[model samples]
Target chain A: MHELGIVFYIIRDVKAAAAENSVQRISAVVMNIGEVSTVVPEYLTDCWRWAADKEPLLKGSELKINMIPAVTQCQDCGQEYETVKYGKTCPHCGSGNTFLLKGNEVEIKEIEVPNN
Target chain B: MDKVRVIEIKKSVFAENEQDANALRQELKDRGVYLLNLMSAPGSGKTTTLIKTINLLKDKLRIAVMEADIDSDVDAVKIKEATGIQSIQLHTGGMCHLDAEMTRQGLDGLDLDGVDLVILENVGNLVCPAEFDTGAARNAMILSVPEGHDKPLKYPLMFSVCDVVVINKMDVAPYFDFDLEKCKEYIAMRNPNAKVIPICAKTGEGVEAFAQWLLEQVQTLKH
Candidate 1:
């Protein structure tokens, strides 16, 4: 649902960046999708295709998403691990007392474009 | 054709939005206002809670509201009619989450000079609104009893980011078999520090408690 809006912003930014760099066409857009984010990669790609095709520079550009798993740092044991299990307590320390460190991000990390 | 990089920007996607929200926080802080971003699913009694809170605390604290919705300002109009406090409606158009820039624009239309507390009723959703920080002093998420106990587990970020969790529609608990203890446990597991308060917005059962807590938060912000 919201992925469409986010994809629009990403395409706009990437296109602006490409134009600034004087790139004729963008090959691909790489994004880091946090596991915690509600965005589904499939939905994002679907929306990207629909939205990107409207722009000439992004007509054939591909949307590449790299999933980042949610990790947490345990306060008791000072350990970090990936946890897909909901209500994830630290496995090693068995502490429900852990803070999320990373993996909650949606960022365009890189854009591949042919140099004119 | 020569390729020239005008700006080699390595900026974040939400950097601009974050900046504006940060500015809003500072502005609210300077105004001695306790900004609270209230988030909840639709029909969670967010508006009812506000109506009760306004009745209890409006006389003591100067209050203002910025209401966010996808379509109508009906809620804002209702709040204004109920409380008669200055209110502004932020039409998100189609955005699920009310970001910093929208909030900043919302504040621009608000008069924060005489306000001691600012309440933002975020767009109704359990997922998207959790990501954007609206530069509020406190973020609250409301969960009504009818929405089921598994909401916190399904939408962990919303509960995790909230400083306070309001369990609204407590009067209907018996009918729905909503586990109060389990709900608290789920929220605690995700956010140990979040204060969980249960209230029946229709009966105004725990509105006093909420208003008191908000007053204390505002007082704390002053010093």
Candidate 2:
């Protein structure tokens, strides 16, 4: 549901990037999606396929997602664990005082453009 | 012959929105209007809580409400009739959440010169709403008793982003397996600074505390 909204943002950013580089058309847009970012990559791709086709710059351009694994750090015992597998509780020391270190990203990594 | 080349443009998707939200917050501060972005899951009593709080503070503050939804004026209408204050609806055009740009557009529709406090009823959803910054002076959310205390664990981003977590439906807490203390603990675990105010919006129990908290916030920010 929210993935469609995210698709619009990606398109806007991709367009801006295209304009900055004087790129007439884009080949593909690569994104860094996090495991805990709450954005389903499949839904995002589906929405991208629908919305990207409408934009002339993004028409036929693929949206590539690079999945970033979520990691959590425990303050009590200075240990890092997988966020999706262990959650808030630290598996090593069993501490609830844990925080996410990464994997909340929905970032546009790069844009592939066809050059003559 | 067309050679495929990669243009390095590493940027967070929300970076632009975050910048816009910061700028909007500063602008609102300069204009002396406190924008409160209220969010919650559907059926979490956000409208009811707003009605109760607006009625309490409307006398002290000139408030305006913006109801953001995919498509509906019902919340906007309900707010206008219940509080008898200035209220307007913002259609998100099927978007799950309102970004800073949408919020700015919504604010443009209202007369901000005389308005001291502007409360934006963000679209109902705990997930996407928390991800986007709406340029509000403060962010608050309602977590009802029926939603379970584990919501904070499930939706850490939402809990972490909210400044205030209003525990609505306290009257029905006994009927549900909701532990107020445990809920507060989970919220604290997620956000150490988040203020938790328990209230029963239906029975108007403990609403004064929530109202007073809001009043003090507006006074502190606007004054």
Candidate 3:
């Protein structure tokens, strides 16, 4: 739902970064998407297809999403493990005493572009 | 002809939004207005809370509102009619969440010289609003009892980012099997520091407590 808005921001940032570095055309935008984030990767790509076409540098650029599994660290037992899905309690100590360690990221880690 | 390992620059994806939100936060603080960005699902009684809050604290504080919606000014109109307060309704067209730029525009339209508290009623969506920081001093989220107790688990980011949590629609607790304890536990588990207050906006139960807490938060920001 809000993936489109986020996609716009991603494109905006990547373009700005690319322009700053004198990159002419973006080939791909790499993202680290947390499993727990509400953004759907497919929907994001769909939005990318539409929004990127308007910009010359990103006309054919592809959005590459790297899915990160949701992992949590138990505060009580000091154990760390991947959650079953998005909100499964820690399996090691059965403690709701867990904090999210990763898998909430929605960041563009890198960008690939043509250097001219 | 393929030679060098070009440029390697690592930058944040949300740099622009982050920058804009930071500016907005500073602006609000400079104007001596405590801003609270409110978020919740649709039909969560956010408007009712605002109405009740205005009634309770209008005499003691100079309060204004910026209401964000997708298509309607109905909520803003309601707030104005009920409280006689100055409120500007921002229609984001089709956007689900309000961004820093939008919030800045709204703030520009406001008279903040004497405003003590400014409340931004975010679009009725839990997930997106949490991601966009509108430079507010605090992020407050509402969860209605009818929406169920599993909300904190399903929407962890919203709960985790909240400085205050309002469990609205408590009057319906007798009819619905809403687990109040579970809701509190879930919110506490997600965010230990968030202040959770239960309210029934329809019956005006706990509205006074909510207003008092909000007033204290604003007072703290003044110092």
lDDT of 1 by residue, B1-223 (tens): 4342223444456666677778889988887878899999998989989999998998899999999999888999999999999999999888788887778788889987878988999999988788778899899988999999989888888898999999999998999999999999989878889999999889999888899999999999999
- Worst lDDT 10-window in candidate 3 chain A: A83-92
Model 2 off-target regions past 4 Å? none
lDDT of 2 by residue, A1-116 (tens): 78998899989998998899999999899999999888999999999999999999889999999999999999999999999998889999898898889998999999999887
lDDT sort, best first: 2, 3, 1
Candidate 1 segments exceeding 4 Å error: A12-16, A19-25, A54-60, A69-82, A85-87, A90-102, B1-12
Q: Isolated chain A: TM-score per model?
A: 0.88, 0.98, 0.91
Better of 1 and 3 by DockQ: 3
Which parts of model 3 are misplaced by more than 4 Å? A75-79, A85-88, B1-9
Clash pairs, candidate 3, are none
Please tell me which predicted candidate would have the highest lDDT against the true structure. 2
- Please provide, for model 2 over B1-223, each residue's C-alpha lDDT reduced to its tens digit, 9 standing for 90 to 100: 5589999989999999999999999999999899999999999999999999999999999999999999969999999999899899999998999999999999999988789899999999999999899999999999999999899988888999999999999988888989988989989988999999999999899899988988898889866
lDDT of 3 by residue, B126-195 (tens): 8889888888989998899889988998888899999999999988887789999998898987899999
TM-score of model 2's chain A: 0.98
Better of 1 and 3 by lDDT: 3
TM-scores of all predicted structures: 0.87, 0.96, 0.91
Rank ordering of all candidates by TM-score, starting from the highest: 2, 3, 1
lDDT of 3 by residue, A1-116 (tens): 99889888887787778778877788888888888766799999999999988989889888888898988888988888876553456677677777889877788878776544
User: How does model 1 score on DockQ?
Assistant: 0.30
Error of 2 at A34 (Å): 1.3
